[model samples]
Target: MKETVFLTGAGSGIGKAIAKKLSADGYDLVLIGRRLNKLQETATEINRPSECLELDLSLGSQIVTDTVKSWIQDHSENQVIGLVNNAGQFLRSPFGDDQDDWDLLFQVNLMGPVNLTRALWPHFQKNREGRIVNISSNLGQTPVAGTSAYSALKAALDNFTKCLALEGGAFNIRVNSVAPGLVDTPIHDFHQKDDSGSLQLKAALHGMHPLSRMGQAEDIAGAVSYFLNPNNSWTTGAILNVDGGLSLTSKDP
Candidate 1:
């Protein structure tokens, strides 16, 4: 029987890359995201057995837990061995901007993962083995000017990863996070009002990375795969930085 993995935000960007990599590496996938069409697109591209679940992480904890339970019931043949908590909201706001944005960020980034993990805890305990990888941000460890809420949520997620690792250790479950730097994806398109601004912003991001280029989605995906691999069974609670050396430098370029 093939091992199955549940992945949130599997519609695009790093999540999509992770889906492709894991599929190619011979694991079936359960793709979860808000857009069914986009998730289906990713599933089709992977060309493997996958279930596309349209879910919004901002809906709160109970909803996510119920949805996950339903998913498990619906897909009984596939034994879920791993979970990738990659869904996140990026809000670029200074303090005192929109309080709603901050709440939404926390809901999606921190609470969603927490709820999902709580729901899956019993399942992992029953199985006696599991893997969890969270897609965090470089700003989680290094603070920046404009991304206060995003950074805080990711930092919380990083800490949550450690806590889950400790709790799940005796059950033979491992939890880790991959903190990625700037990657060229639609997530940044929100700030790109026009082609010129987009290009300039992209260039600036590239310059900020000590490696001299923005990271690719696959770069983060590779790190996620490393943690998910059963060969790395002894490792847990690790925050792997797949940031193109961006963490080493300040934001100024």
Candidate 2:
């Protein structure tokens, strides 16, 4: 029986890369994202029995929970091997300027992952084996100007990931998180436009990281892949930094 991985935000960037990597390695997939086209594109690329669920994680927290229940019920025989709560929202509001949007960021970044993981916990326990990987960000670990709300939400997620791991250890469910630094993705484009910055500013941000280069989507995906692999069964509640060393290099001081 093939392992089944239920992944959120499996439409682009790191999420998409993870999907491809898992699919290539022969895992059945259940993918969720807001964009149907992108989801379909990912499914097509993988060429496997994949379900692309179009869901806005920010709007339907309960729905995410319920949907996972249904997915588990349907795939009972196959091990629901892993879950990657990789969907997120990045807003450029300076903390309190846009209350509603900031709230939505928290909803997608933190609440949705918690709800979905909680929903899937029973299924993971039933199998006595599972992996949960949260795709966090470097901003969550290090301070970033103008990203107060986003950073706070991600920090909450990191703490939550830790708590989940501690609880899941006895059940053999390895829970971990990966924090990506400056990744070349659409989220960067969104922030650049919102920040009114030149390309050089973005390049400078990428250069500050230890590798002195923006991380590729596959860079983060590889970390997630490692976490999902059953060989690393003893590792849980670990937060890995895939940021090219940006957390060590301070842009402010």
Q: Considering every candidate listed, which one attains the maximal TM-score?
A: 1
In order of listing, the candidates' clash counts read 0, 0
What is the Cα-based TM-score of model 2? 0.93
Stretches of candidate 2 exceeding 4 Å from the true structure: 191-197
Model 1: per-residue lDDT, tens digit, 67-116? 98998887788899999999887887668895887888878888889888
Full-model lDDT for every candidate: 0.89, 0.84
lDDT of 2 at 219: 92
Error of 2 at 177 (Å): 0.5
Assess the local accuracy of residue 236 in candidate 1 as a C-alpha lDDT between 0 and 100.
Answer: 99
Measured against the true structure, the TM-scores of the candidates, in listed sequence, are: 0.97, 0.93
Report the C-alpha lDDT of model 2 over 1-253, residue by residue, as the tens digit: 7788989889998889999988877889889989999999999888778988888887765788777777767776767788899998787666558687677887888888988888888888987888999988888888678878788888888898899898888889889999888788887665555455657677776678779888999998899888988788889989899988888877641
Candidate 2 Cα deviation (angstroms), residue 45: 1.1
Evaluated at residue 84, the lDDT of candidate 2 is 94
Best by lDDT: 1
What are the runs in model 1 whose C-alpha is more than 4 Å off? Answer: none
